[model samples]
Target: FFFVACETHRARAMQDRYVLVLVGVIIITFLTFHQEICKAPFMPHLTDPEPPPLPPMLMQSKRQLLPDMDAEAPPATDVPSPTDPAPQLPPDPPPTGALLPLGPSLLLYKPTTAPMWDPTFVPRWQHLVSIPIMRSRHSMRLLDLCITSILYMTPYPKFDVLIMLDPPSRALIRKSFLEGRLEALNAQYLMVPDPIYVDDFYTGKYWWVDWPMLTQYKKVLYIDNDVLINADLNDMFDAYDMEGGGHIYAAQEGEFWRMWKSTPMFGLTWYKKTDYDRMNAKGIQSFNAGILMFVPDQIFVTNILEMRKWMLKWMEREIPHFTDQSFVNHWFNTRLLSKSILHKIQLFPEHRSYPGKILLHWCASFGTPASVKYDKMSSYLTTFIEPRLPKRYASRDAMVAGLLRPQMVIAEVGCFTGNFSQVLLETQPKELHLIDWFKGQGSGSDADGGTVVKLPGDQALQMLQDRFASSPQVNIHRNNSLHALAALQDRSLDAVYLDGDRGYDWLMQDMLLASAKVKPGGWIMGHDFYTYDRVTNKKAEKSLNPDVEKTVNAFLQASGLKIYAVGLDKQTSFAIRLMHPVFWFK
Candidate 1:
């Protein structure tokens, strides 16, 4: 009975122990499930990531509001339905000053604000003139001056210049006169065949024999390179077209029949001594072939095809001094006799002949040395021609003279009336480029505080050309400032003066381009840098440009450059010196 009682006790004890173990296991499982699934607020776990640290206060986007569920819904048409696609807004524009990546390592900043230059712009020209350039240096110089005079003084802008030359002469002109590029002069070249070598004058004059070959043009005016056209030649051309019926009209030689007296007439089988007597008695004389208006088609029947044959067969030899003048005079005289007319055929009236009432011809071969004639021409250009034109404004140019030194390569980007350019010239720069669109200006305050009258662009252009035409150092570019600035080679200028477009973008572009073009240690300068009031930074009376100061400061800051100097003139000017090599932003 005692053993059975003990076994019963042991079994009961074992069951109680199993029940405790089962209860403990159930509690552990409940805790694990609660922690994993419920994640209670009060319960902390090792795996739970700390709530993401609050975002930066300023960077955090505003919280979008959810529609209130309890609020009364608006009319269906008032708001878009929840299922409808969201409205789209345009993406914002990219920043203006974003750095343009140059390469893997380098980045540059170029302005995207300014309008790019038009690369396709070309002036359409109408009138054309043929200017014959000789192989000699003296003649080339004369040609240059002649071109300058015609461009500046003619008062007409439609004329296109054509250079008549042979291969050797063309090469010579290209090397010496054109600096190895014919396009520099903006002229076309016409090749002459088997050019005559003359000691006295250029053989280009003889090209009249081949005028018929120039089938492209109906009428052509021939002017010597030594002549400076002071007035319009259109009237002369018009007169010839109206009065000269398929014939030539020319200025008479200074000495009338005396020039043709020694010519051989015996070679003309159809001519008689009486014809010569009648011609001399009637005051009939050969015209100076230097300047002629001729119909190219009229001479097609006479010696037009064979160049060498005409010279050998018809040339008068009694006066051994041979020239195109003698040949044309002899040839045309015979043509005139066939038509039974003497003075009426070729001679222009006395008013247009000899002393040249309209234009000046420096008959260089007539007893004067070519060098002497050139000097005289230069003197006449500066002293006589320049003084005759009006000075549009009071002098503000003297102030800039102090900034420039002799023989510097200088460019004035916006020269008006050449007032500042005159001072630049006085400094004797090796080359001075005067650039302007010459698009006219309204009445404005002058340097002396007087109101100047309105000026037209054409008149302004004419004035600028007249004022500077005599100066070999002055080169005028009638173009947009952007176009002109871009045409310059980078790092080629010693200094660039900007008084061009005053708009913020334009000023910035000009400054940037000028900075790029200037050599290291060179200056970039501009006008109207400050207001007349000098303080308040506002556009004061007489201060035409309000954006100059801001644009200049911005450019200086960007380029890491500083203002070197400022002018003391009433209309203030500023200058920047580039100390180091510039790596211009894109």
Candidate 2:
């Protein structure tokens, strides 16, 4: 019975062993399959949604989820939207052109190639930019004398006048003119503190004007109050013709240049701060404060201030010959390297005047009365003297004689007197448009006293009314010709006459505007064609027969308007118009 029991136990142990072996084999097989599946490369399942939720069948089968540790997932195939921020692009290269170095030290050369021509060219070649280095003592008499000389001598009607005055001289009046005359000329004035010459340095009460003038005009022909200008300055503007150059063109000391060619005073010298320093070190040149054109940049201004301080410190040491003038000449000689720029320096020849083309400088030695009485001075003053007042064109006689014909509308510009309108009235024109600035009242009034109707609150309207109050038939417009022309309807007038301000720019502006108002083939006439030489004072030797030559030439060149007839009245030359030529008028 014991043998049989032991055999039964052995049998039971064998059965248990068999079952354990079988289970181990099955587990190994499942793990091997899972390892194989995880190691396999993945193919994108584009058609499936949510990646099949991690395979529930594998979890139920008791398989390992990831047996292999080496493989990577495939990269994404779809790109991001273009609207997303992109990487920055590289910058473009710079353009290729000729380059130039700038500063006062460098001498610039004009290029051989011709400069592009500009129609509105003013000769700035010889133009002098003056800066007055004023001391405390204001020189009002000198200032007046210089200003009067400028006014009398300048040939051009307009100038950019800069007056740097001391703060104290703000209320002082430089010009003695009637109230009406002052308004006619548009002049700009400014006042600032003088840096070089302070108020406490000198007790001369007259120094206030000098300080003011120096402070106001940065780039000017700073004339000492005692000096006089007696030449036409148009040549000065010609200096701008130089292709490439620097600032501070000056006149040479003729006497000095004649003595020594290689000497520092060979010609007018231009010096900046560096040049000034070099000159002081080498003892070459000095500064001149007399009639000069100052190039007013920050560097130059600072240098000027420094130079002024140096001068004051050495005032006791240096025996003053010409005061600042000799110093200036010395400064130019020491600093300026190349004498090529000095080619423009024109000296006052012994027989000929200094600034023969532009100005005459009458120093203090001449005395005020003698200076004023000089032949050049007399001639200068006579140029601006107004001629005898012109006689009025008789309105009734003109109309009766068929000099004036009835038209759809009569347009008269620059109606100094309403004589033309008066003539138009006799012909009973349907409309009369009179345009003028009317500088003089009653100067252009007609016999009938029917001129422009002045309206209140109209800036332009008031001007026309004040000037043309005598002419009842004429309707006055105070606005600029360009503005008036823009307001008019097409073919609004039958006849148009223009005689406003005399300037190429002004004439052109008026002509462009008037062309729009006149009907096709309508009459257009102008005045002052024959008065150029008379107006410019260029007719001393030549006869004053500029009526057709000057004005008509300019008018034709400007507007291509043909001259129909030259009506020879007693004093005035009147131009009648032909039909607007198709080729030329436009």
Candidate 3:
């Protein structure tokens, strides 16, 4: 029994050990799993992928809005390769200016302290620009002053012209520029330190320093009062080698460079050879200070003022040589700056005329204050200058011109004051029959065409008589257009231009008369097709002539007439008549 009891106790102890071993294994497994779960967040799985991109804040557009947009455009124009001038913005335009419409037609600007010329004066440059323009109200006959300035503006009408002034001068400028032409011209006036009295000249060219203001322009030109422009300065501006050291554009002073050295200064003292040679050398050219072209900048301005100061000191201590020109010759010729000349384009000899002469410098050309100086200047007005000026026109110029030919019989039905007859005259028609009543609803009507003078019916007849007096091609009948047109033989005229009496009845009557007179396939063109008032910037509620449009449409509808072209330009309608088979045969 004792042996059996000992064996049972040993078995129980072995069973307890087995239970302990199993419990220890379970605790170790739980601890290891918990540690692995904690570590899983810090180390991500390798198989995971990135999230998607966010939507746009707003809808995107594919439409092109830039010059460089990936679509084709006209190959870009090269920026003007003018003198290596720094880029420039045009001057701020002056405030609302006053127009003097009375005698001379002057426009006055609100003046500012802008400098007259550019800070950099490039000597003998070709491109043109300016400082300012002012009108003079003085003794020199206004016509002389006006024509002289007009010469400067003729070539550069595309740019602003600075006329230095007579109030009456604007009249000539206006006639030269504004009359029957459209040009992008702005007249600028420069105010200088005044009391410049040489032969009572008001332009005061001697006070050129006061011209350029603000120094903001890329290129500036000083066209002498005497110089005539042959072409625009764009070519000249481009001609310069802009890869430059600072320079000003001016003409070589020619004989004056050599002449002034020997001539007495102000007729007082002879310029010694050594003193003259200091500022003059064959290698170093003396440029005319009278006309200059330059870019405006701080350095250019500093040089100009410094040279002027020195010249003034020289002039005050001794008799001045060659007036203000002495300052320029000394400034550049001292090896102080760089300048160049294309020769044929710049200064020409006084006694010799070259075929390639683009600019004429008359500083001493007329020889010691000639009497007919202005008379010679005025002659250019009729010669090369006016012929080259551009003519601007309303739309449909070619269309209007193409309809007629030389020696074709035509009539102008509403030939009020023979305004449009001038254009038709260019075709040199065989016979131009003009029919008009020449009477209007008193004055202030389109009948007088807003001219200062109002013509009565009799006066209108007389005016046409005098205008066509030189040419036997014109025939005039001052009567009721209906009466006159009714009396005419059918199919007598090639065409009729109706610019007469407004209102439905008048327009229809004129059209009917034109229909009777004009041949089949002949055209009828009239003014005021669509109502437009420039000041209103909208279609007119009522046309200048009511039913001008309605009558035209009704005529076309009734007659079965095909309109070749229907156009509106300068507020005038151009329509061509097509032949109907019945009318042509009948």
- In model 2, how many backbone clashes occur? 59
Provide the lDDT at 484 for model 1: 92
lDDT of 1 by residue, 202-260 (tens): 23454544432343455556677666655444444444432334355565554334443
Kindly list the per-residue Cα lDDT of model 3 for residues 185-304, writing each as its tens digit: 233444342221121121234334455442545565665545544444444455555322346667665543556545432111333344346534645455666467666566766766
TM-score of 3: 0.39
| Candidate 2 Cα errors over 4 Å, as ranges | 1-159, 166-175, 178-220, 226-234, 240-247, 254-289, 316-321, 337-356, 364-586
Least accurate 10 contiguous residues by lDDT in model 2: 99-108
Per-residue error for 48 in candidate 2, Å, reads 99
lDDT of 2 by residue, 1-586 (tens): 3543555566577877665555567667879999977754232211123222322322332113222212332122111112223223212212421111111111111122221222333332223333232322234334444454443344232334434444333333423221111212222333333222111121111222332223333344555444445443434455433321223434444433233223332222223344445544553422223455544444444445444433332232222223355344543354342122323233331234343345444442211343343444445333422111111243224422333355457777766545455555666777788775533332332223224344233444454466557656568776566666667786677667665665666675565556566654355555544422334533233323343345456666655444433333322334333223222344
Better of 2 and 3 by lDDT: 3
Better of 1 and 2 by lDDT: 1
Error of 2 at 241 (Å): 5.3
Note the Cα lDDT for every prediction shown: 0.53, 0.40, 0.49
**Model number with the top lDDT:** 1
lDDT of 3 at 223: 58
Per-residue error for 450 in candidate 3, Å, reads 33
lDDT value, candidate 2, whole model: 0.40
Q: What are the models' TM-scores?
A: 0.43, 0.36, 0.39
